[model samples]
Target: MKKWAIYVVLCILTPAIVKAQAVVADSVHMTSKKKVPKVQYGVASFYHNKFEGRKTANGEIFSQKKLTAACNTLPLNCWVRVTNIRNNRSVILRITDRMHPLNKRLIDLSHAAAKTLGYTGHGLTRVKVEYLGKTKPVELNLMEQPAQP
Candidate 1:
C-alpha cells in the first residue's frame, strides 16, 4: 500500500517540478550600457566559404546566409551597425555569440554581412560599430507618430 501511494505522489509532483525548471529565455542580448568601447574604424569583412555552417562563438552553429556577426564584448543577441569608412559601406548584424576569445578583432562578420557591406574580396576591413541599444517596439499614437520620437 505504501509503495503504491509513493508512486502516485511522485507522479503528481513531477510535472510541477518540470514546469518550474522551464523559463523561456526569450533572447540572450548584450549591449553597451555604461560606455561604448573604443572601436577600430576602417575596412571590415566576413568569413565566406571557409566558415559557412560552422559553429559560431555562440552555442548555435553558424549559418553564413544569416545576417549575423560576432563581437568581443557586446552582449549576446544584441544588434550593431558596422560601417566601412573606406567606401562608406555599412551593414547591420546581430550578435550571435561571443567573439574570438583570444583575438583583439572587434567583430566577425558573416559572409552575408560582409557582402552587404561590399567586403567580398578583401575578407577583412576596418569598420566602425555603434550599439543602438536593446530591441523594443515603439508605441504609435493616433497620428502614426512613434511615442519615443
Candidate 2:
C-alpha cells in the first residue's frame, strides 16, 4: 500500500518537474540569443593634420590615412562602425586613441575615415556609432619552418 502511494505521488509530481525543466530550458534558450549591438548617436569630428604623427592611446602611431578613431568611452583596440547620418556613409574604424576630457564630440575619427564618411569638409557631423566588439590581434610567425621527412 505504501509503495502504491509513493508511485501515485511520483506520477503526479513527474509531469510538474518535467514541465518546470522545460520552462527553464526555454528561458535559457531565449537568453542565449545573440544580444543586439549597442548604438549611439552623436556629433563626430576628425583629427587635424597636426595630429597625424602623434602617438595614440594604444601606443599606435596616429595616422590620418588609417581608419582609426579617438573615442572617449569605447575601449582601445575595439572596432566600431561610424556612420554619417547626413550622407549615410559608413566606415569601420579601430578605436586607438581617446578624446579630450572637455570635448563634447562622440568620436574623433581619422581624416581618412571622415573623408570616407563624407564629413571631412564639415569638420563635424551627426553620426551613428555602433559598438562592434574587440578585435583579435593578428599573430605573425616570421621564422622559416624546418622541412619534414
**Candidate 1, residue 76: lDDT:** 72
lDDT of 2 by residue, 1-149 (tens): 99999999999999999999999999998887565447989999999889888898999899999989998777789888889999898877789999889999999999899999997677999999998877632311222345569
What would the TM-score be for candidate 1 when compared with the true structure? 0.59
Give candidate 1 regions above 4 Å deviation.
1-43, 48-50, 136-149
lDDT of each: 0.69, 0.86
- In model 2, residue pairs whose N, Cα or C atoms come closer than 3 Å (at least 3 residues apart or on different chains), thus clashing, are none
- Report clashes for each candidate as comma-separated counts: 7, 0
| Candidate 1 lDDT over residue span 1-149, tens digit each | 99999999999999987766553222222332446553545334465576766776667788888878877677677667788766877766678866557766777888888888887777777889877545621321233565674
